[model samples]
Target: MTIGKTPPRGETIYWVNGKHPWVSISDMVEYGTILTTKEKVSVNAEKLFGDITPTGTLLMSFKLTVGRTAILSIEAYHNEAIISIYPFIDNEYSARNYLFYILPIIANLGDSKDAIKGKTLNSKSLYNLLTPLPPLKEQKRIVAKIEELFDKLK
Candidate 1:
């Protein structure tokens, strides 16, 4: 559970175009898997950003548009407004699909207590958030059920 780097600016920033996929909140889609972003940076920027977020990482935007989630399908660097999670680590009571469905609800429920702007969710907000944690098997079952129900809507 690490937040993204501060965006590069001034001479430290280089537009490398495709060498590095840089994700910002706008690039994320509802329940989408992100393989490429609308922006990119050079190795210089990556160094400044500190890490090449590995593929398959689960990411959620915790800023102004709180709780928009996505899984990275390509190695990428994202802005400070996002946080990346190692899926297999705490992916326990949380399924990617489940989070996609639940986080926004939690964010909305606590909006009045957050920063005096749009509902911005941050690490502290995350730590304070209390959610139901069923067994891992039940989580998987719930995700499957949600998907099945959504598929029926198509």
Candidate 2:
């Protein structure tokens, strides 16, 4: 329920998944963020979606089909449909996967009105939701389990 204080374009703004053709809007658009292979000091907006953010931010879909969450694993900018979260500043640090898991719960808890017809969860409605925060250690454990299960699938 708190409005985040965002720095200007270059001050504290770091985009992850900096590669185009990576960050997409569902299955239609493509390459929303940017791509950088920098080992450190890099964030990626694409992988952030269903992925993680290191020294990063969270991106929530804002347009069309909204409320989808993303994490900044690398530094990059995101589309307007996404609301970025800087856990470092907010003191809300948790594993990116943990955010992905809990965001769905928040979205379901929030109000749902079909403003754009089928798109009931637009950016405005989705971003205003709140969820509980688990300790970083617990989050890490959860993320590890998530990765372990996902790795089994591959």
Candidate 3:
């Protein structure tokens, strides 16, 4: 949603109190997994915020904390501090798992800028962020390898 069109806090009546996962930067962790969320909104709030971002959408924190990333296991809504990135349609190379792994690196590029309040990667900066685009097969292989390595670490 646009900055000018942000829903006011007084609209909490639309919040269903745990019906829809509402994510914030505070919910992000370094492990790249969004296991749970403390906030939720009602269906009305979901409609107001466009739509619930689908499960598996990659969420990245760009404001204060800068490079935290996570994959949404449940469909959810997120505040402005988090940007929900959906895989590109018709692009075989657009793997959500692969993007989850690489987005933190892409987010780090925006960390060079300084904001008066805190480090911020504005919408324009986020829109302009570049990412690697390996072939679909290669992306799947990379994701598998990463998972295997992570399992080994566990």
Every candidate's lDDT = 0.74, 0.48, 0.72
RMSD of 1: 2.8
Q: What C-alpha RMSD separates each model from the true structure?
A: 2.8, 9.5, 3.3
lDDT of 1 by residue, 56-90 (tens): 77788887777788888899999888888653534
Who is ahead in lDDT, 2 or 3? 3
Best candidate, TM-score = 1
lDDT, candidate 3, 24-140, per-residue tens: 888777746776887777767755787677776778777778867787788778887787776765254348778778777877886346877678787778777877878888888
The TM-score between candidate 1 and the true structure equals 0.82
lDDT of 2 by residue, 2-88 (tens): 122212335322333234322334422221222443322134333333333333555555444545665545544333344555554
Supply the TM-score for candidate 3: 0.79
The residue-level lDDT of candidate 2 at 54 comes to 38
Arrange candidates by TM-score, descending.
1, 3, 2
Identify the superior model by TM-score, candidate 2 or candidate 3. 3
Best by lDDT: 1
Q: How would you order the candidates by lDDT, starting with the best? A: 1, 3, 2
List where candidate 3 sits over 4 angstroms from the true fold: 1-6, 16-18, 89-94
